[model samples]
Structures are given as C-alpha cells and as structure tokens.
Target: MAFSPLVDQLLDALRVLPGVGPKTAQRMAMHLLERDRDGGRQLARVLMQAAEDVGYCQRCRTLTEQPLCELCESPRREDRLLCIVESPGDMLAIEEAGGFRGRYFVLHGHLSPLDGIGPDDLGLDALDAVMEQAGVDEVILATNPTVEGEATAHYLAQQLKPRGVTLSRLAYGVPMGGELEYVDGGTLSRAFMGRQPFND
Candidate 1:
C-alpha cells in the first residue's frame, strides 16, 4: 500500500519540529487526516501567520509582533537593571516567576565557537548600544547553566566590565548544564533572588 504524496509531505514537514520523530510525524499526519480537518486548517493558518508576522525585537532580540517586545516597551520595568538571557523563552520563564522587575536582553543564542557562534553573531553591538542609550546601571547574566551558556556569560562579563555597569551572574540553584526553560519556576525565582556580582 502506497501512501499519498500529500500524506508523506505532511509527515516530513511535521518532523522538522524538535522531538517529532518520523513515527510521531506519521501518527500526527494520520490523526490530522482522520479526525481534525478544521483544527488542522486553523493550525496551518496560525503557523503561517506567526511565521510571517513575528519578528525579533530591535532592542532585546526577543520574538515580537511589534518593533520592540512587551518587556522593552513597558515603562514600569526597571531600566537600570537588565537581565541577559539566551532566548525569549528564558525571559518568559523569569517573567512567570514574578521575581524580576527589571528589563531583559535576549541573546537569541549562546556562544558556541565549535558551532561557529560568536559575540558578534549574538547581537552584542545592539546590546552595547542599548546599554549606552538606556544608561543601564546593572547587567545580570541570566544565561542557562550549560557550558556554552557559562562561556557566553563570561565573555559578556569580560567585554562589559570596563563599561562601568555592575555585572552579576545568576545564582547556582539552577542545576549545572541545565536549561533555563526546563527549570522549575521556584528554582528560577530563587536563582534570580540569590544572584551574585561577577567581579571577574
């Protein structure tokens, strides 16, 4: 029995998402065909719309529909305190914990020289511009606990040290090599609360 081209194409497209293996993709294709035409159409429409409309914030580099993300646009947020995170999801996690009242800067990725990522690739220039324009007094490096995250944090610390802003790193409550998105809300909140100044 041969599967139709459309079915095979749907399965292949679904597999592009992380953790969606061939089996899961096939199952999803079958399920969409068997039980969910309206839902599938809505899903496709929303995915296309989001892909076309969502873009990175000019200030923080977080995904946003507007020129700047909500965090950057908010006037109530503490502009003097900035938290540097690897991705928008990490920013969301910290926001959800409700412990951080400061602004955020999303790097979009960690420094991984083996994978060809570098400081310039992570929008450090924009970050520097933001710091200069906003008169940021403190920068909290809230990147994940992974090796690359640590490396990125250290690199940023070194570069920004002479800029005269107080630099701090998130506390060690987050397990080593763990991602910010996967850590529990309590742990993330505690990490923010216990953050220490990075003198080096």
Candidate 2:
C-alpha cells in the first residue's frame, strides 16, 4: 500500500482537499506521476502562486490579491444596498445569478460558539464600521439557510439595528419548477410564513 515517501506525501496533500478520499488522492497522485508531469507542474505552480498572492479584500473580506475586490471597486454597483454572505463562493453564486447590483460583505464563516468562532472572528466590527459610514440604506442577509447561518444573520441584525439601515432576509421557498409534495417540511413552512398576498 506504500509507494515512495514523496508519492505518499503527494497523496496525503491531495487528501487535504474537500471530498478527496484516499483512493481519489492515490489516483490523482498516480496520474500526475505517470501520465502528465507537465500538468502537475502547472497545477503546483498556479496553486503556490495563488496561495501566496490571494488575500482578503479589505472592503468586503472576500478573497482578492488587491486591497479591494472588483465588486467593491465597481462604480455601477449599488452602494445603498449591501448583501452579506457567508463565503466568497456564496458571493460568486449571487454574482453569477445576475440582476443584483449591490455590494457584498463576506463573513468567511458563520457563528459557532462550540467551535470558538464568534462575532469578532467573523469581523462584525468591520461590518459595523461599514454600516456606520457607508451610507447604506438596505442590508440583505444572504447567509445560507442553516442553523449557523441563521444565527449569524440574527446576530448581525441585532448588531446593525442601531445603525438604522433596513434589514431584510432572503426569501426561502419551493423552487419554481418543484412540486409542493416533494418539498421538505422546513422549506414548506418557511414558504408559508413568508407568503405574499395575491394581487388584484
């Protein structure tokens, strides 16, 4: 089961990635060593470069090499509406969906007291500073629909309440093409609670 020490090290390193098990890591390491050393070299170079260069955007806390991210620097984005998300990936998903013209604040993570993460760790002070001076009118809670995400959003709402900005949470409901019967109970309940009146 053991190859060379370097190959074992490569497999272990590959396993550090999310969802990459021992077998997958072994296959990847083997493929790199046996098939495409050039591709592996390119991957290593790019990975090292990105790891060394990529840092948090000062304005939004999302991953960026610069002091601010492209979204934060965009003149066309709506400064009045601020969308708060839990991670850079979430921000990217919202951006890709389009139509939203607001700025974003990435928390990088959610509240989990058991894990020792709190408001300070999430950079709530920076967000508080933003709300105080950014002239923002609306703050959208776009955190994921989970216990931790909800707790983080609620904590943010409490903290930002004094700032006087209108706070809103993203709507949770059944998908447009999904049947109600197939929808889970929690989703159905949330949809029911957030239902709107029919128009004339």
Candidate with top lDDT is 2
- Model 2 pairs in collision: none
TM of each candidate vs. truth: 0.85, 0.95
Judged by whole-model lDDT over C-alpha atoms, candidate 2 comes out at 0.91
Worst 10 residues of 2 by lDDT: 125-134
The segments of candidate 2 whose C-alpha lies over 4 angstroms from its true place after superposition are: none
lDDT (10s digit) by residue, model 2, range 95-162: 89998998999999999999999889987878877777678999999999999999999999998888
lDDT string, candidate 1, 1-200, tens digits: 65898888898899889999988998898899999989999999999999999999999889998998877888998889999999989999999989898899999999998999988889999998899998899999999888899899999999999989999987667888999999999888878988878998
Clashes per model (N, Cα, C within 3 A): 0, 0
Worst 10 residues of 1 by lDDT: 169-178
**TM-score, candidate number 2:** 0.95
Local distance difference test values of all predictions, in order: 0.90, 0.91
Model 1 gets an lDDT of 0.90
Task: Give me the displacement of residue 115 in model 2, in angstroms.
Answer: 0.4
